[model samples]
Target: MDTATASKNPDTRSATDRGLPWAEIDTVLFDMDGTLLDLHFDNRYWRELIPDEYARLHAHEPELARQRLFAEMERIRGQLRWYCLDHWVRFTGLDLLALKVRLERHIALHPHALDVLDTLRVQGKRLVLVTNAHPEVYAFKHARTGLGNHLHRVVSAHALDCAKEEGCFWERLQTVERYDPQRSLLVDDNLAALASARAAGVEHLRGVRYPDSRGPAMQSVDFHLLESLAELLPDRRLHAYASSPV
Candidate 1:
């Protein structure tokens, strides 16, 4: 695919035109939630359901429970523990994994995400799923979405004892799963993770413009912004696909 012309909109086209060496990319790293899958599930689970469950368990008002939980979440916002269900279980004295299993219905792939995955598979790209999600959380989502079947490997940042935001995480990741940073592309929803990967020398980087399907689109990004995964499809195929009915 010629990324420059495959962009879904003018803003994305402008970003793609900025000399991205897409032809040289061999390894494609993907972030799980938001990048490939819809992020609404995670947002609602953490912001709404968790607070409601906490209130039910603690005999507190929903608003009070939300305040307390939000405070704790904020304290560890960017830390590894923030993505760990085991850490949450210990912190909240609640079975988080079980709760997640019950809420599995909310899990879903982003629009045209499967189409993009299929295209990458056909193109023989080395696909890798990288996420900050804890092993239990990753397992649940992987099982629910079957995203693992499409990838060469699934990596949890917890395995490296660091969040993707940390430079050390990339170093640790390289040692475990070797890939040339210069020939690789990483598509992630988190700007911090993309920045970390860039610092680690990953050549091609793309960010999802709307990580949360129900939320407003992001303003401007330093790297290529993908409005839809369909934007990565081959130009001729994309044109035909777009013209087809839903």
Candidate 2:
């Protein structure tokens, strides 16, 4: 059965499958950090190591350092600088990127992320890595994950001069990477970015319910949530990966 027709029929398997309708999607925009790679590295870096190190350097109580840093982060939470490592270095007087690179051992792909990308690549999908990460951060993660090899293009918000949380990001993204919003799908863990995509007319959105495997459950309330990218695969491939040695 055709995709649209299959989606309409309650008895059709497509209705039961949570995977994207590949036939209808042309370009697949993926969020690199939490959506593809495990988010724990960033979480631990920002929430744990940074705080501990900052407290050590500044001679402040551990709790005070975390509280101070959290307040500073809140002030620029959804802005581009929030993702800027240079800005963080200047603000915190810390060599953030070097610290991140040192923590690269913790960087890893989410389960089945590679398999899903392999399937999409062979199908000739336009896979784009769209991220709010600063270029330095992107480079480090790329070194660890080799995500650049699999993507048609890698876009950093710094290059666009806008964060994904902002609505204009989609328009700016098109200036460099042309895509039909209605025929595109974005798998992102950030709710703000998903909302921005929806507002910009992107047709499909999937949110990661557990972006940080080492952390608690995340909120993906307005958009469809996937427990893992494994859910994006067809039953046959999913079972194969599950049974295969990790």
Candidate 3:
């Protein structure tokens, strides 16, 4: 798909706009961490809290112990095992929910995230959040962040028994949600997860890079490289007339 094409609205064409191949994407599935919210929360929680909690449990130097556990956690961040907060807490024996709440207290949504979600909802699109986070962790995050109000559904990989890296997870999500893959767009920061959805026949995919990052995204499944969800608003009207295959 030559995603860099001329948009229907000539006034609003971006330099990268060959335009997305699929005509109109209705169902937008968003990945939470790096896509909608900043990823520093997860990184800090595991790298800092897990070890401090462990040290408190064992009477060791909390700072030094945090470094040790952070090193261990860093080695497995991308693996499927790390996707589940419960599994991590079980192995490390930390109260994951308590730790998550700590992170959630400072957590905030990405700039324009709420605007984009609201625009899609106003346009009558079904907004489903497909995240790899455990139910409790995201639940706490949502309560604090107010992201729950913007989404139609929030489906976690834990409930599906498949992380995005696993083949059957996307299939299970489609089966349960009855979402049309072709007419849907899945946005995530994880390249592997985006590719997994692409392999499952999802046509439109976008990768979101964080606002503070100077580097490009580390993934290839992105049809659109979005700096923020707010970018969708101005040009969405162009796609309003373009009929997407349902």
Highest lDDT model number: 2
lDDT per residue (tens digit) for residues 1-246 in model 2: 111112222331245345678788889899988899989898988887898888887784767877888899999999999998888898889888778876788998887788778777887789999999998888888887887888889999999999999988999999999999999999999999999999999998888877887777676448887765755664444446543443
RMSD per model, one decimal: 3.6, 5.8, 6.8
How accurate locally is residue 192 in candidate 2, as Cα lDDT from 0 to 100?
A: 91
- Pairs in clash, predicted candidate 1: none
> Could you give candidate 3's per-residue lDDT for residues 1-246 as a string of tens digits?
111221322343356654454347768889998788767676666556666778787675766666666676778766656777666677667777867677665476765677678877887888899988888878888888889899999998888888986678889997668888899888888877878888998878777655223233443434556644545653666343232211
- TM-score per candidate, chains pooled: 0.88, 0.88, 0.77
What's the lDDT of the predicted structure labeled candidate 1?
Answer: 0.79
Q: What is the C-alpha lDDT of each candidate?
A: 0.79, 0.81, 0.70
Off by over 4 Å in 3: 1-18, 21-23, 55-79, 211-223, 234-246
* lDDT rank order: 2, 1, 3
Residue 9 shift from truth in candidate 2, angstroms: 25
**Candidate 1 lDDT score at position 130:** 86
